[model samples]
Target: MYPQVLFQNRKPDRIATLEEYRKSGGYEAITESLKNRSHKDIQEILLESDLLGRGGAAFPAGRKIMTVSDDAPYPRYVICNADEMEPGTFKDRVLIHADPHMLIEGMLIAGYAARAEKGIIFIRPEYENAARILEREIGLAEEAGFLGENILGSDYSFSIDVHRSGGRYICGEVTAQLNALEGKRPNPKQPPPYPTEKGLWGKPTVTQNVETLCCMPHILRNGAQWFKDLALTEAGAGTKIYCVSGKVNRPGCYELPMGVKLSEIIEEHAGGMKNGAEFKACLPGGASTRFLSREHYHIPMDFNSLREAGHRLGTAAIMVFDEDTCMVAATLNLLEFFARESCGWCTPCREGVPYLKDLMWRIEHGQGEEKFLSMLRKQSKYLWISYCAFAPGAMSPVEGLLNDFEDEVMAHIRQKRCPFKGGE
Candidate 1:
């Protein structure tokens, strides 16, 4: 059975109010923490829980908090990374839209643990509705003494501010986010000085994903053991918001245990493939992840498990494709997105992606031979060794397609046309 932590009192079409949320025992954990637990105690609880970052890196969240707590003198800042810019990842937007108060409570608890005096929700510009809801909800929270000065009548005071990004994919990176918050272009910088030591105007800061922060209230209320038990596998813990897209009959978000089977999610949760289309393959995570064919659907969806299966559970955005889909065309489409979004910070990503896209175009159009395939394969190696995550991530779909759908690619070469030319 799916846990109620993620969708407890969910009204799919409407957002929950503070009053409604409080009635469902929403802020009780935070209220208890403010009244009873000290900053050190909260930090200890987090460490004991072993909660990893819900964002891409999967670093231990508790250790990060402790680093900020120990390094910063007195007032640190906590930033909730709400910039859900990854193309197929929209679970964060849904969570924030559904329950704004949950996020506020979680942020408050996190701020207390990190000894932070201020918090910021760095949201994407595309999430206009989410930002509006957060702003209004935050105002309500302040009036209710949950935010702003002297929160909950405790000596620990904290404030939260909502800021919108100028619209860029790299802005999702921590360093780029810090730069954007400081009124600069969103570009990543070299790091020996991590965010914990020097961040946000040279003050210590801790950044967490929107989903990561929202999980805090439940963690505090239910205890770390309960949270750990939520995992379907040893490597992962708690419920995850799985966003299903592409050719599924019902392409939407479903909250399930961390290691739920991909087949179960596709057939049961996503309502199976559309038009009774035969399942071909899936990008188990977002576009950045490697593709997994129908044979791999039995594998569990978790951080390390997915990696062991030769893919990354990146943002848990499962994009399914049916037999009718053209593998080469699909690979080209994803490469186009990566090429366009490249920040040009590194030479490989800036040039390699576009070049790879051109190679795919030539091959897809059947204007090439074995030489083109060889060149693309060699270019992928260079991309993998690039400066940042973008170049390597950008190569995933192409490499996966080449490895898993070599026959389809060869058909394009032989026929000089896309196999599914008329949408199969």
Candidate 2:
């Protein structure tokens, strides 16, 4: 019942069909909004819902909508950012594969509210199945007159396009994705002309995360207060699809109320540690979030709680590590991914990430020194100087390793070998 809003159509056969979704009252919210509500009315409902972006930043959705210029130009655009390539993050992929129409309905609502003439689902290249599912569903919606010109017999018209990812992690960023969709090299753009003001051929645009958009129809269907009450935390609203990986026995996604305790997720939902291993630490939200040790296992896994605890709810993709796992190796693996994913657009990311990766490799291989650790510490402090969140995300694993496992780094130097190697 907790995740009913999202997992309502989880039955394999029933989930993928338009008829089932319609029978389940799918698209009713968008139909209602498009037919009865004005653009301002929809925005007001969103603002009152207190929904936050689920794409790592946790920014307010209503405020983002308000930033779009009321009279910018013709053909405003809305992009559903489905290019979810963050390491250990797969919640969006599951959502897309299981219930694509939910995303479509949500996009229609957002496009209508933003007064957008077009919408695009910029999905990841690796998600071939999801891309196929979306492509098929779009055709269905179009045939049903839910997507093409003149929807539900109204003047409001919106069209959606699917753009496959450029096989780069940078495209997950809002502006970077816009650049890629426009047939340019994917790289982060400087702010101030923040998409909503000047985007997609210099027209006003509103870009939203897939998961964020998926929540819209639910919010509109059940009042704003109902959405707010879905959270376990007082400060948060709605449910969060938490992705579990690493040391957990049952590593998969679970849509639970926000503010659910970390222990509940790890022990109850994830079925505790695998192979009887003890939990050492975890990257609470994919590779880019700070590590939380056993001390933080009791904290609520929500936006405000994680922030207050000096971490972020990044993608809500949790990567756990057991006692037997080597922190240096784990950190090195994440660094390798970030370093390779850098778009070479800025020196701080392109250059710094490789250097960080090399440092992690050396340390993981038992060739590290006090100087290497010092070099790592000094280099990581400046990784946040990049133009976008990429470099800063690259630095997150380093921060976690240093903060929670400095002793392991020192042990590599003191013992002249990786102590955790070969099962210690």
Candidate 3:
């Protein structure tokens, strides 16, 4: 069994109360920070810890903190991004249900480090229960003096608010979420003045996903070296909350050490493929990431390892598939999601995603031609030219299907029918 850090107190039923959290050294980091640490001190420790954002992007948390200038204007905002809308991902919801205080404590510490007095948990509509849990727990924390107005006998004060928000897949993006908070149309904005420099009512803002923030209390409580030592790989810093699904015996979240082998996760942790299913391929991350073929089955499920292998550790939401699954149909299903959830801000995504979806639709329904494959290959490249990462992300499984499973695709084209489905 791997050492549990984030899920240490995870209960089978009900939430861990404030008292329970306190007993397990929750919020101790805030005390330690107030008494002994400075902004630079916190920044340096975070940098040294090398805590990558667990929110799929893997951006360095320290760099984001450092970007918020120390002399930046007052009313700086720190946002806890709880919009866990990525398909096949639900780690955030699980984390909140297990222990909500960890997120609150993380926000407090982050707010102090960022010199922001206000913290907002920007949650999605689907997570109604998770949002309520956070709201109730936040009030409890305030009553105990962990939040609002000169916290814990110190000059530092931090307050958190839960912003139950409009649902959109694109709003999960930082800039888009900020815009949504301001009651504007949610759209991804390019960084010149990044969110850390200017955001949310034009004030300096620091935004982080729930899983990333949840790691803060633990990182600050343990020293940087201790945090680094938690990973199985030198390149990794901490354990990953892997959300496993599809064809697996235990389709749930497991907080395993970073850089654990994909085989180990599927075999030892996830109880292997379900009901004697033979593994064909898997979307190693969320729906947005490219598929990992059977050849890479033994690959280490880490950011560096996956990147080096021309893949991503996207949300770590491994969607496994059995041999019976059709690659073309699977890609089409993913495209259907991209088509519907598209923000329609840019041409490539607004038009390109649906066009691809249409092509995939025809192909699956036996209207595909030999020329359609090359046409797809040609147009899919344009998705990268879009305004945001969405188009590019949506193209992942398609690229994988074309790149790794061209034989399967050719089978469909030659037969004028899906190989897995009997049709003329």
Point out where model 3 deviates above 4 Å. 422-424
Tens-digit per-residue lDDT, 1-424, candidate 2: 4657787787654346888778878999988987789888888889999999999999889788887767878789999998888989998988887788999999999998889989998988898878888888999999998999889899989989888887888898988887887898988789878889889878888999999999999999998999999998899899989999988899998989989999899999999999988888888887888888888988898999989988898999999889998888888888889988999998888899999899878777777878987899889977878878888888888888898889988988788778887332
Name every residue pair that clashes in candidate 2: none
Ranking by lDDT: 3, 2, 1
Cα deviation at 309, candidate 3, in Å, is 0.5
- Name the candidate that leads on TM-score: 3
The lDDT, on a scale of 0 to 1, for candidate 1 is 0.86
> lDDT per residue, candidate 3, 197-307, as tens digits?
888898899998888889888999988898889899989988899999998899999999999999999999999999888988999989999999999999988899999
**Which lDDT tens digits does candidate 1 get at residues 165-250?**
98888888899899999998777876869887789988888999988888888889988888888989987888888999999989
Off by over 4 Å in 1: 69-71, 422-424
Give the number of the best model, judged by lDDT: 3
lDDT of residue 220 for candidate 3: 92
Clashes of each: 0, 0, 0
Itemize residue pairs with steric clashes in candidate 1: none
Please give the lDDT score at residue 212 for candidate 2: 94
Preferred candidate (TM-score higher): 1 or 3: 3
Better of 1 and 2 by TM-score: 2
TM-score of 3: 0.98
